[model samples]
Target chain A: MGDALLEVKDLVVEFKTRRGALRAVDGVSFALKPGEVLGLVGESGAGKSLTGAAVIGLLEPPGHIAAGSVTLGGERIDTLPREAMRKVRGKRIGMVFQDPLTSLNPLYTVGEQLTETIRTHLPVNQAEARQRAIDLLNDVGIPAASRRLDSYPHEFSGGMRQRVVIALALAAEPEVVIADEPTTALDVSVQAQIISVLKNLCTEKGTAVILVTHDMGVIAETADRVAVMYAGRIVEIGPVRDVIKQPVHPYTMGLMGSIPDPQGGAERLVQIPGAMPRLNAIPVGCAFNPRCQMAIDRCRVERPTMRRIGATDVACHVAGPAETTP
Target chain B: MLAFLIRRVFQAVIVMLTVAFISFSLFRFVGDPISTMVGQDATIADRQAMARELGLDQPFIVQFWRFIAKAVQGEFGISYRVGRPVMDLIQERLPATLELAFCAAIFALVFGIFFGVYTALRRDSWLTKVVMTVSLIGVSLPTFLIGIGLIYLFSVELKWLPSFGRGETVKIGGWTTGFLTESGLKSLILPTITLGLFQMTLIMRLVRSEMLEVLRTDYIKFARARGLSDRAVHFGHALKNTLIPVITIMGIKLGALVAFAIITETVFQWPGVGFLFISSVQSVDVPMMASYLLLVALFFVIVNLTVDLAYFAVDPRLRISAVATRG
Candidate 1:
């Protein structure tokens, strides 16, 4: 019970489809303490990105939070009005998107874009904002900060643009940062650089971060704690090392085994077979039962509740006591 | 950038030459201007002498060369019907046509973009629906019908404005203030509105669509995510992206404006190049027709060139590529 910077309890998000109302994120609960990084790992359509969007109050139309309580820095933000939520969005909870190239405007110079954010959140004049923009560019590792400030987003490389995006998120010195697959668009070599920059900056500022990524390697390298989601529900939550080295939930184990290790010799990587069910046609029982290798008879008739097993939390009837790490 | 400009200038010259040659050939196809102007009842000797005097009997290539040479030297010859210098006739009427087109274009750009942005921002709202419906009608209705409709409403019904003609003369230096005043503007109002209404609708639709598309870009969403205000996202980010296509259409529309002006001027009996052009065409005045056609063609080329250059200013990517090519 360290002081939680953000706490999402019993969060449920639903979308009204042509068929009927479909729950995308159901009763998901998570908390982030100051200076903590919570990696939300899930397959596509697992509602990880939707969760991030809900946290920031940007869940687009048709998909909305049906039931939830989101407390940020001691304030209940879930029920806050639109104007109030907007004030908290960039000033308190910043967001970095998946595609860095499309996440920056082509018309504006990078400096102009950055300065606009600073000016909006801060009580600063144009000259001060401009100076802050130059400082941010320098902080983000862009060369010739002053000169590059005038350069457009297209002028920068993919990784550099991601850095600029991070710079924008950190411009107002927000309390939390939600980076949704920030490195997914960059090359593998550049991913590490961006992750390191983000980690170092968050650490220095004691800002909580919610990193939504599907890459397990990114989670192991950057996250303090990880939440593995399957079909829009968190199947497992624990310390990064514990979850990766010894996963409790069957789905988590399948995810960990799916990754091919470069150091290890040729081994058939275990993959969770079958596609995720569409949002409109979810199974009646546990969402992962169809894909779970160790699913029992009860797993097909009832959804599992998240129960504590030693140091980890798992939502599976078959999840017994935690196994000792090898 | 300089290379682009040079290439554009060369293209413009080719366009002008094509216009000159086509209009010249087309006017001749209708028959010799001298014979047509003099009438069919004239004696064969009189017609032959008239043809020879006017250089109409020369070889087609030689006639084209002579026409081009005279045109370049500002000697457009005399109007066969008016019996006055074609240049003098055009000079007198050119200002009025240019002024009408300029004013209409300005009105269209200002109101069209403003309405477009407003509707896009308020998409699916009642205001947007009304604007879109109006735009559809404006685009579908022919310019003549709109002009006639406006004349009937403003002139025949309201009687608040003049129905035809340029109206009473005002002092040259005081023209700006005089023309924009209640009465001065009243005279030009019907034609300007008729021209601007259709163009404004077209421009508005273009801007609205382009802005809507630009607004959906991830960067605009990111801008909102960064806590930038709605104004910043819509105007600063979205609007800037929309302007490129809008400008491109506007350039092409300017050429259309000149062509439309011909019909508008005739309907209103306004003293403009369009009215002069219509009369020249009716009376078989070849030099007047050629000069007017050449000017309109030149207008399109220059406007398009300006638009091409504007692309460099709006997006640095173009400027960079342009520079790269030059280097």
Candidate 2:
């Protein structure tokens, strides 16, 4: 409790579309400790990406943080001016994008991109930066790192390019890294390899990471804790294993049910009715009420905030709170 | 890479040969240079003697063969109006046109890119809108009209410059006195502005569109996210990507510039090759006219070559493999 590396307090993000100002990230709160991997899981349009973007002060215009504060290392970051925020980015918090193919500038060599970022945020001469770049490429498990530095982005394969992107993000050795769908763009086989590489590197450096993805397998494998988001709000937050084993929120339960069970007894996977609502069509009170199997009048009329249960915070009126057993 | 260069050179050679044939056929097909030369006072015997003296008395086939032979040997015969070799006249006037084109291109390129990028960055500003509207006018107005208008304002009304000619000059040591002289330079201002204005607008539009598109690419987002200043992200990362289109447009515009300068030269009455070309056309000077077309074609080929070489130089993607280029 005393040493929170990154803390996001009720972050609200909205977009000024033609229809109206739609809330993308609505009062989302979470904390990340040093060296901790917090997995942000949600269905499509859950605003998982938007929350991550807001924490880094990069919410796309006309999407902006309406009310919230993102604090890293006890300093408020979200309120900083653009230039100050920019410096805070590479120097304090780094980011990885979903698509790697377009991430690296095609004109520059892999080494040049790494070295430029390193030189910008760190006090290093060209030779030292080049050496660091090679070391980073090597650290990312690239073979013949020194030779590969001269190759352009096009010369690298998709998986390898993602690896280079990771290297570039970690160039400054920032306190935290927000990797948004880092593995979604890679092969399933390569996904495990990249995940392992990311985990090992972050763990070794003691750098906190907010791993944003829809893959439960990724959360299960890598995350110490997980936050489940639905309709731009967190529905559940707890230790990964506790929430996965003793699921609290109905939305979280439905999400887990949708994942196929390894034990073959249940022939068909459970399916939640209807789809996640669009920004305009999201129902009042509980955003998931229309699709929930156990929706009540109470669920349809009043929004629920996080209530402490057994080793978890579950947002639901029906479930109430977990009682301690004798 | 060698193969590409060889292929390009071969294509250029074929184009030159084609232009030569087209220019040669213009004299035979048009069939009135001798009539224009003799005028209403000259008799038939005088015309015949003149034809014999000029070797036009030979059979059409013989004359064609001789013309081709002489053209291949870098001769374009003599201009009746100038009473000198067409090649010599072209050589004398070509430098003036080239200097004008080069100066105009430099002005357009520098300012065009500056304004284009400036406006693109602040797209919603009223200044940007005004610049874009004025640039559209630059694109739509005829060069001769612009030339005359500039002359009207700068030369006639203001009495700031000479209205016609390249002005006088004397050779002094290594430097030329007239070309570099104050009055000569003052005479240059209107024509250069007229020649460059349209190109400036064209380049501005191209740079704006390209920069806008490039600014949206993922790499630029990544660059900004990585703590790059706006200047570095805009000019360094995004602008570099815009180069491919800018260079391509510049090459095409340069080729057009050589051809389009004729109207500007006529309006200014400047003693450049374009002005000479117009007078040659009116006087029915076939050799002079033929050489003028050939000269422009040559410049086009040269500009295209420069563009190709520039691509190889500036963009590593177009350069031979990194391994080959490393040396």
Candidate 3:
């Protein structure tokens, strides 16, 4: 990217357990450009969500960033003190969690939540904040925004509540938004609507977004660039279309193969054999070596670093032209 | 809201009637009121004449109906032990008992919530451990023993306060209050603490566990993520949710404080309804005992009703549901 808005370098997150220190996110790094939508796609426990939480300085206790440098607008943020970092979150970088139903405080109305957030970061009076909250709700496509301001979370349906959560996140007009599985908790019918609403609002504001999700289809629909993670490391990262059409990493290829092709007349979808290794029992060299069909002796002996191929960067020892682009 | 109130009131009426029936049967079967009324020297003819005069010779159903009617009108007849109207006696002692209970409830609620939130926030601190240990003792110790212990310390040993009685009370209109005057206020401390200790500990434990649970909820995490100050997140978001269950417990415990203040009252010899109740029991005063039971049951009904109404104030979900049903 010509000018990156946010940069995460050599980020490593570890949890202190009774057994010992267990690394959850191992040396993950990526750059997000201004106004660009960067999708982080991975299976569960793949550290996609953890990485997002780390960037915002919100890793729960016992789980901390062991070693990392996160920069926003060319200024280092990972090392900022707690109070200073709090100002950065929801002001410089907003967050949208997985479940909208639980994301909102049930005791407060949507208006109060939105306005309180707005007033927390911005230098505005209550009346002005209230007006801004109404505007934000309207921007997220909630009808009668002013009238619905007094309604509690339970009064709204799942989709409407999500819209309110998005409005609250965008109330401060943050430079970047980290949405972690925003649509996963919604209905299939409303999932697309929520994604479109999120996409349209961020796009309109020229706000950069880090969309963390496990759905490759969602990434295709919303992300400008995509990073595919496996076992807490990025297996491949590139332009969404390029990575989807020509995945070089074996893990990414297997992932793309597993998704059902709606147009193609295949009765059964391709499935990757075996399961991802647990954090405690990950193989020393290539974490995917045991399950990768093209694993060689070298692949078993040493982990591969990212090597650029075409428009994508992949981390696989056996990545070569032998496996044709599907 | 009106419908909810109406339903609650209806339920309260049923409860009161059930309690009334139980107390009625207790007075009817527990002792012979005529023998106590006439004294031991009265002949059989005198006893029969006295029974007829009091309508005790009527059918059981008719007598019970008359008792219920008189009770509704606040007439519980005369106390056999004191030779006074039971209602008048209760009314005279009512202020002392209410004042004692009210003070105890306030102490328990304020300190319990404060200590609860403090301990929950600083769970790993040494101070929290000490508070929890002390609260455990407060919970485990019996009420009368706690009262006696306080009296021995503050009254007998230190000689700082009076050991027994409501000292130098002031009468304001119909209510005789010990709230004013230095000695009267000093007299209340031991009894209040002794009565409040168990409820305070119970509320503290409840609030602490609830606060811990609320802190782990997703809404709390989301609030933190939204960059709300730690104070705002903890108190504004988490504490409000924690209080929903605490309110119910506090309401029920407050009612229990009033009904069961008999032990603390007897220990301190505070002139309250519970003391009267204890004395009436010793003398086998059926009218006083029955009326006391009815009064306690009535107090519980009012407390439970207030708690239900308070839920509507604290939680918006209930209010919305009520509106939805109405619409």
Error of 3 at A53 (Å): 1.3
Report chain B TM per candidate.
0.95, 0.92, 0.96
**Could you tell me how far off, in angstroms, the CA of residue A226 lies in candidate 1 after the best superposition?**
0.7
Best by lDDT: 3
lDDT of 2 by residue, B13-103 (tens): 8898788777867766665677888889999999999989888878866766676678778998899777899888887777778778887
**Which parts of model 3 have CA positions greater than 4 angstroms off?**
A321-326, B33-42, B49-55
| RMSD, one per candidate, in order | 2.1, 2.7, 1.9
For model 1, the stretches where C-alpha displacement exceeds 4 angstroms are A324-326, B171-181
CA lDDT of each candidate?
0.87, 0.86, 0.91
Docking class of 3: medium
Better of 1 and 2 by lDDT: 1
User: After best superposition, candidate 3 residue A110: deviation in angstroms?
Assistant: 1.2
> What does DockQ give for each predicted structure?
0.81, 0.71, 0.72
Model 1 DockQ (Cα-based): 0.81
Which portion of correct inter-chain contacts appears in model 3?
Answer: 0.59
Q: Candidate 2's C-alpha lDDT?
A: 0.86
- A best-first ranking of the candidates according to their lDDT comes to 3, 1, 2
Q: Report the C-alpha lDDT of model 3 over A214-249, residue by residue, as the tens digit.
A: 999899999999999989999899999988988899
lDDT by residue (B1-327, candidate 1, tens digit) is 666778889888888999999999888876557666787799989988888988888998898899899988989888898999999888777767877888889889999999999998898799889989989999899888988888898889988788888776455642322264566567777888788888899999999999989887898889888888777778888998999989999999977788789889988888888999888878888888999999889888888988888888898788777777788
